[model samples]
Target: MPSRSRYDVVIVGGGHNGLVAAAYLAGAGRRVAVLERLDAAGGAAVSGTPFPGVAARLSRFAYLVSLLPRRVVQDLGLRLELRRRPFASYTPTVRDGAPTGLLVGDGEERVRTSFTRLTGDEREYVAWRAFYARTGRLAGRVFPTLTEPLPSRAELRARVADEAVWSAVFERPLGETVEETFADDLVRGVVLTDALIGTFAHAHDPSLAQNRCFLYHVIGQGSGDWDVPVGGMGAVTGALLEAAVAAGAEIATGHEVTGIATDGRGAEVAWRTDAGEGVLGAGTVLVNASPSELARLLGEPGPPAPEGSQLKVNMLLRRLPALRDPAVDPREAFAGTFHVAEGYAELETAYREAAAGRPPTVPPSEVYCHSLTDPTILSPALAADGYHTMTLFGLHTPARLFSGDPADRERTRERLVADALAALDTHLAEPLADCLAVDADGRPCLEVRTPGDLEDELRLPGGHIFHGDLAFPHRAEEGEPADQAERWGVATGHRNVLLCGAGAVRGGGVSGVGGHNAAMAVLGR
Candidate 1:
């Protein structure tokens, strides 16, 4: 079972980030070994058709791509393709029980008109644009620095220079900024939604995790657009997998890295596979698992379980549901992000209920029809059969909700599916369930993945998507270590260990910066 007694590096996980690290190190002629617990790599970035007999492929857990650097693509010689959606998002609003909506993107005039109709004024739209312009400036100055060494606080702030930018984002509660910036409650919520997505935190979280989440959500290569991987997320990961293998990196899936220890000479990785237990000697060990899980394997107490609050539901619709507002065609409406019951107060109410150990009556959620932008996800038979896919992500669904009695948690998640869909159905011309593509067993081609489901399936610490709560990218402010570790911001307390996953600084999303920076640290680049 052992290829050799030791390798130059033994990465503890085979996630995209780990693969990225291995690819780089191996390309530089270092012996690399990647050990993954599962039969497959890709971690959260994978695609599959879960519904039995459903011909349409769904992105499953993690859908879409943003923050993946173009440099990573070119450097690895990956043949991945990212297709941009023409429309950014279409949100339905109701007044007097009449369903109307704001269709953002497609055209500037239509977007402005939608805002005016909803607010009875054009004030909020102008403010929204001004807000982006400011963040745009900040993105320009900071986004480029992600792949390089981390900048100190003073250096970054001096780079930004604008007092308003610091006061609004880096220093204050994001809620105050959102509330102050947008006048209408719905408009404010649309902006605030980015702050809370997948994060079980309020807009006013003093820890500023919400701010960090918001920052990563927008700083997607300075464009802030989440592009659809043409053949689903699998293509992106598959390409990386190919590059890693081609570069002479050894990948062993189903080999769970169970322990790690470091010595003066080198580090050691202990893993369990079907064959038996084996220890791989390495000059350094790269851990791509969540810090909490990594800590456990290192025999240390991980931090208090990180909170993750999102319900992911995958469905195959026979046809796009008709929107109550026909001005925006259903195809155009669902082509981009779609919001449901996510008003500002609505979001707060849901967070309150979930924090109080109850699921919200109306869960704030968003949906994207990936097939709308990339029809390659659908088989010709399915596409001709009028099938499409919708991936819905619900907010304010903490791990605590599913941390209750096992039966109770199951029931709560089930109820959330009903409530979240009901919220979305309110804006549709017909019941969304009516468009379901049924399986041969007569079960609807739909699947729900709760936080509990994630913990069970992926070994994620609390199923937190960014591995842990999102952390600021830079080694800034007080209490940061001073050294080369601070430069890349990927080093661990152990000299020989480094993080190359979502827990690393700037590790959020599918960005390979964490892995790239980790390799740089090892290579002294």
Candidate 2:
């Protein structure tokens, strides 16, 4: 039971976003309460020791910090350190029967040499630099607007002040820009990968879904750099949990919000616990759940099920796997994103196959070794013994492929894992399985999470990470309501109900913008 039956604000879902809202509102002297379904509060932004008795805590679901703003960190006084990676990305490929790779952001001279080796000239390298410089400028101009009220299309375009850059990213399809800017298939793929992360869209998607996804990935805190949290991702949520609790917010876990009834002025939040059912009255209800889930709770027909389009695999390696490209050290290659079978053609082919209801012949994926950047997640002994962690994200593996008869789904999972490893093995000197760290039970220290598994465990409908497709931070091109709540981008059909989760505008990745904007709307800022 809560401290009282009524609260100034009742927040449903204790994900990092919810905690952010709780901390801000509670600190402002508002009576706040956060109800979570799970026993924990972090939601997807959590770390767990997945392998039994492994003594290594892995960032189970979401990894890396990109969109978190400095303002939120300072406002909450959070104790967190985000370390930048020295290398940006490494993509392995073969040219004319010889094995080679391109390493970006390692060093200017080295990157130029690698690009020349792969493309037979310096034109591709020059184009790559010029293209990113354009995005960098766009990031600087647009990222700060995310935490504030929604910007009108015209206002954002004027703020950018560069019609060409704005039109390339916001107006036209992203694939057109990539095709016109760069000629090398591999380089183009690396740039376009940002657009397709967790999104089941092709490069030329007319809806500009890929453009929206790419914008969020590139506009993180005015720098597109994705930093590693010192501790696992849990450190992020831990800091939020601390701030919220210290501010006198009541956090009740294991209480599932079952229903919400609002009548313009106030809202009633009905929840279920192991013991029984209860209701909490709130002058304002902040829903941190997905919009589809919110519709279900409200007894309304939600949109079609959202299908997540990525396969996540977590592995603990006794030692880093050897690379086929001997010039680049394995440490450097794994430090940043390692691109495997992700050339532009490969990505398109995979998308076509997945759209046709078949698994990709060659899975396009990227691997990240967080331990190389932040070793605090590992035990002292593991860190000293050359042990490391790898997170492999395979694109174009939609949830539809994994949802079917139980036996068929199992077979699909096995085949997808094998295909992903095979794609990675093309760039490795030795089999990746050889580097596995076995647990006390003698099982391999690897875990595969499919969309179905995530849906069952995390209550994520169709396992869509951003709750559904991501929306642009600004108001739509058609038009938007001029009301304050509408301008804040947190309004719901009900006057007193607001969205404060990934389903909200400007919500995606691990950013707490949704929560902050919702609080601002409630406070009438």
Candidate 3:
């Protein structure tokens, strides 16, 4: 049945952010409704058993959780858990006859030994740690501000309080910073990769979108760690759903919100459910949709269509692949982020090619074996069989490259996947394809998500994962509600409707900053 035709707040899009907002608002004793277009919630933070006759549930889209705030978890009393990976990353040079490249974490001696090859001395490694130490401090200062009223950029820079740190990160191009800081080209490329993950810009793009993206990737929980959720990505969302329901939030799945209007008086939402169309009246509307989608719902012009530049590949490996470096076990190499063909110079080359209307010749991507860190993701049968799930996030392959006719798009996807797999082969002792788990159909258990695929699946405008290019977290002006400094930074130019999704300020990842901020904005907290 439909909700009471009215609510204190109607949250459109039952993504994790929406659910977070619903929980906060409902917990405050407000009547709330969360309408999800899909039959279930979670958005990209979902898990599913993609392979038939196989019981392993793969975290379909997003595979890691880092930005979710500890405060939110504690405040909501969520039982969600996240497991840390001891090995941070291993970069495998695709060059033949070259060693297995570099791996960070595991042991300080091994990591320092790897760094000596790149740094030639401890000076460079010292500099690397110093650089992140400064950024880590900055992350600590900035993360707490995310859910509060917008702070001026000057205030934020002042809070960090170091001119050199501010200039190197916020002012100088990230490319220049990495080049100046790291002596090794591959090491520099590894640092810059964080800047380019899903961003389509070069490290030196004048817009500094790369810098912002890099900052977000590095500054999670003030530790710069991207941890694996205890179960899968679904665990985070499942907990959010649980918290919201416990707080008296009504969630209606399969309810696709189609229209929204807001005035000084209140907000109205129209949706298409399985039964029929319905309109909801609410004192306020919290939108978990992308900014472009929200703009369309509000009958306004959307931003320039954003584009997603990543190709994600998910596979169930029959067993861990053999590593080229005999000294390092496959368990340690694959546990954290595994990089392939991601040397700095190569990254630049791939970015230039993709920018020049082509997919990367050597497709730069990262892979991680999730089961290595958390065995709970696998069923007992699969666990006994030594099967593990791996996720690959391919960078710089823009959506525009797949913009041709249908057949051409498919061809591009196939070529990209083939090239990516071929690159991953360079670091393995044996071909990775040989280790792929066979599905019921006798085919390899694999799935590739192109930028177009993300668009179709998640309604991510242009498949842009962060909704759009990340904007600076603060408003330009200081201390003025009229100037947007006093708003929770969730305001959508609508008095009573606000954005609580990746498009909102400080929004992205599985973080509920937008959700928390929106609720705070409504509650005058």
lDDT of each: 0.86, 0.91, 0.86
lDDT of model 3, residue 93: 59
1 versus 2: better lDDT goes to: 2
Q: Which parts of model 1 are misplaced by more than 4 Å?
A: 477-483
- Give lDDT: candidate 3, residue 62: 90
lDDT string, candidate 3, 7-26, tens digits: 99999999999999999999
Cα deviation of 281, candidate 2, in Å: 0.5
TM-score of each: 0.97, 0.98, 0.97
- Writing each residue's lDDT as its tens digit, candidate 1 over 13-79 gives 8888998998999999999999999999988888997877777778878898888888888898998
Clashes of each: 1, 0, 1
- Whose TM-score is higher: candidate 1's or candidate 2's? 2
lDDT of 1 at 428: 90
Q: Is candidate 2 or candidate 3 better by lDDT?
A: 2
How many steric overlaps does candidate 2 have?
A: 0
How does candidate 2 score on lDDT?
0.91
lDDT by residue for model 2 (1-525), tens = 578999999999999999999999999999999999999999999999999988898999999999999999999999999999989999999888878989987679989998998999999999998988889999999999988889888988998999999899888999999999999999999999999988999999998989999999998979799999989999999999999999989999999999999887888999999999999999999999888888988888887888888899999999999998888899999999999888999999999999999999999999989999999899999999999999999999999999689999999999999999999998999999999999989999989998888888887788888888999788865376656568888877777888999889899789999998898888883
